[model samples]
Every structure is written in structure tokens, then in C-alpha cells.
Target: MVTLMRKQFIIAVIVAALLAIAVTFGVKYAQQGPTLGGDFTLTYRAESFHFAEKAKPLNILYIGYAKCPDVCPMALSHTAQAIKEASEKERSKVQMIFISVDAANDTADAVATYAEQFNPAFIGLTGTKDQIDAAIKLFGASYMIEENKKSYLGYSIAHTDRLYFLDKKGRVRDMISSPRSSEEILQKIKELL
Candidate 1:
């Protein structure tokens, strides 16, 4: 009986040690995934916006202006369709976000409306010019603003076309540039899911 009790005690100690090691490794893995949205604050069209509130969505941040002639809208539409085509379980794990590079024209309400047209769950964000510029710089996207004194607009921005994919843990994993098929983008997003 004494020997049996000693063996059980030893087993318990081993189990405890294994659990501690697993927990440490799990934390390390999560920390190493990606650090995407850690230092940015963007204003979106929502009743009340909080990044922590939308935890279940995969948190995709797209940087473009509402006035983008082609690339931005095309990419956003593709993203929406891709999410729709995903398996129900996979689709539920994604949240597509549009961040406006043109603060002068794109508003939270405008972004929200446009995003809803594609996917109700999609989010649109806009802020001050400085805020927009800061976000663009952080993402390393390049842009050129053209001044136009016509059509009720003073200026417009033309920018590089790129889509950034962030995992559910808010880490940027990969980027998809424009001039690529939506199918290709979908395949990439599917892998991340």
C-alpha cells in the first residue's frame, strides 16, 4: 500500500509539470503569431466601436479610400464573396474591415454603408487626415494625392492596392496585392482560416 501511494503521488507531480509546460508553450506560440493591430486606433461606423468586442471575427484590415477608382472596391467585394463561399465554420471566423486612406471624403457612415453592401459583418473606418496618414505609414502602403478642383471635390488619392490578412489573434500573417484574381485571394484567406 505504501508503494502504491508513492507511485500515485509521483504521477500527480508529473502531470502537474506537464500541464505547466504545455501552458507556457501555448502562450509562446500565440505570442509569436503576429502583431498587426496592436498600435492603431481607427474610427468605424458602428453603434459603439471596440476592437475587443469583435473578438470572434478574423479581423481583416483593408487600407484604401472610398474614392478608389478600382482596386479598393474590387478587393473588398472579393473578400466578401470569399467569406461567403467559405464553410460556415470558416466564414464565422472572419471579419473584413475597410480602412479609408481618404479622410476628406470617406466618413464612418459612408464606410459602414459600403461595407454592409458587401457583408453585413464587414467594418469600415475613417478618421482625421493625420490618423489616416499614420495608418498608411504603419501598413507601409504608398499613395499619391491628386488635387482636383471640380465635381464638388478638391482632391483625390490614388494608392497601391494591397490586402492585409490578420489572424483572429490580431497578427498580420500575409498580404495579397491587387491585379490578382479573387479566387487567389480566397485561397490564401482559406489557408489562414
Candidate 2:
């Protein structure tokens, strides 16, 4: 009877250990966020941009246009602040890519100038209508452009304001929706790094 009880206790301990290991792994995986990716190519400052070829830097992609009056500016400001808050080592490992949704109005020079207003390090990208459409589809983002004669830019573009954080491997690891404080964004970036 004693030997049987000891064997049962050992089996129970083994099962508990296995369960703990599985739970640890599951939690870690869950923290990594959703898996989102597809072919995306664009032109940044007249240069070709391709994620697959650039293997090392963590890319934080923001989809908006230069003409955005509120959301895009705020988002870009917050992102720039977050990047500034990161340690120099951590900052060097990250890249902020702003893709213009208003391909028609946001010329390469315009996009570059707009992005540089936030941070000179920020890269601005835009493409032809078809290329922009393909990139939007790949990133699962939505945007709508409407004529606004009263506005200074002659039009308005409504687009998804969320920031897509892709890891060094070029996999979309996290999608930050809603506005987060610079500190909060920095923490999220650190975790992925």
C-alpha cells in the first residue's frame, strides 16, 4: 500500500509539472499578439522599400496621409516621443515607417516633409494607386478619401490609426489601437526587442 501511494504521488507531481510548462508557453505565445503579414512593397523618398530584404530592424508601421489634420499628427507625435524615450541601443533597433494613404495628393516629397516634421529619422512612403491598394490589402488596413473643397489639402482621408509593430523577423507582432502614452508604447517596444 505504501509503494502504491508513492507511485501515485509521483505521477501527480509529473502531471502538474507538465501542465505548468504548457501554461507558461501558452502565456508567452499569447503575449506576442496576432500573426499578420503578406507581401508589401512601396516607395519611400523615391527609394524602394521591402521588409523581407531588411532583416534586422523592428519596423513600426503607421498608415495615414500627410493631409490628416488630427489623428495622424497625434499618432506620429506619440510614436516619436516613444522612440525618443527608448534607450539609444533600443532606439537603434527600431524603424518608423509612415505609409501615405492619399497616394493621389501625397507626393514623395510631401510625405517626406510631413514625416520629418515629427522626426527626421522617420521614413515616409507612398506609391501609385494600385501599389497603395495592394499594401493596404496586405496590412488589412482601411482608408477612404473624399473631396473637401473647404479644406486646405483639397481632400480628406479617413484611415485606420492603429500602429502595427513588426518584429525584427518582419512578422506583425502587435497592433496598438487607440492612443497610448509614450511610456506605454516604449514598454511594448521593449518587450518585442
Candidate 3:
């Protein structure tokens, strides 16, 4: 009877340990974000740009036009600040990609200039309307170009003002939205790193 009781106790303990391990894995799997799919062959500095060459760097993709009046500038500035705050090693492990939504007005040079104003490390990309539309659809982003007769720019683009954080595997780990401070954005990036 004593031996039987001891075996039963050991089985219970083993079962509890197995249960704990399962729970740990379950929670980790649940926390992982969805993968961002889509292939983009855009122009950067008049050359073709591809994400595949760069390996294992966290990619922060922001879609905005170069002439954006408010939100895009603010968000890019915040991203610059966050990059500045990260350690050299941490910064090296990240890349920021800014894609232009106003393809009609924002040329490759214009996009590069605008992005470099915020951070020289940023890679700015612009594509044809079809390519841009494909990227937008893949990311589930929305944008509309509205003609403004009174405005000097001739038109304005309304787009989703959010930052897409892609992990090493190209999975979207988190989205940092507008109204978030630089520190908040930095913290999110740090957590991913």
C-alpha cells in the first residue's frame, strides 16, 4: 500500500510539471503576432529596394507621403527620437522603411529627402500606383487622395497614421499608433528587441 501511494504521488507531481510546461508554451504561442505578407519591389534612391537582403533586423514600416502636413512628420520624428535613444547595438538591429502613399506627387528623390531629414538611416520607398495598392492591400491599410482646390499642394492624402513593427521573421509584432509619445514608441521597439 505504501509503495502504491508513493507511485501515485510521483505521477501527480509529473502531471503537474507537464501541465506547467504546456501552459508556458501555450501563453508564448498566444502572444505571437500575425505575419505580414506581401512582396514589394519599390524604388529607393532610383534603385530597386528589397527587404529580403537585410536579415534579422526589426523593420518599422511607416506609410505616408512626403508632403504630409502633420501626423507623418510627427510620427517620423518620434521614430527618429526612438532610434536615437536606442543603444548602438540595438539601433543596428533595426531598420526604418518609409513608403510614400502620394505616389503622384512624391517622387523617389522627394521621398528619400523627406525620410533622410528625419534620419539618414531611414530607407524611403515609392512605387507605381499598382505596386503601392498591392502593398496597401497586403497590410490592410487605407489611403485616399483628396483634391484640395484651395491648397497650394493641389491635393492631400488621408492615410492610416500607424507604424507597423515587423519582427526578424517579417511578422507584424505590434503597431504603434498616433498620439503615442517617442518614449512609448521606443519602449515598444525595445520590448521586441
RMSD of each: 8.3, 5.5, 5.5
Candidate 2 residue lDDT tens string, 1-193: 9999999999999999999999999999998755676557888777887767654568888899987889898889999999999999988889888889888779988998899899999988899989988887766789988888998977788899888888665567777886557877798889988
Ranking of candidates on TM-score, top first: 3, 2, 1
**lDDT of candidate 1?**
0.74
Clashes of 2: 0
Residue clash pairs of candidate 1 = 34-171
TM-scores of the candidates are 0.71, 0.78, 0.80
Expressed as tens digits, the lDDT of each residue in 112-161 for candidate 3 is 99999999989889989998888766677889999998778988889989
Query: Model 2 lDDT vs. the true structure?
Result: 0.84
Clashes of each: 1, 0, 0
TM-score of 3: 0.80
Better of 2 and 3 by TM-score: 3
| Candidate 3 or 1, higher lDDT | 3
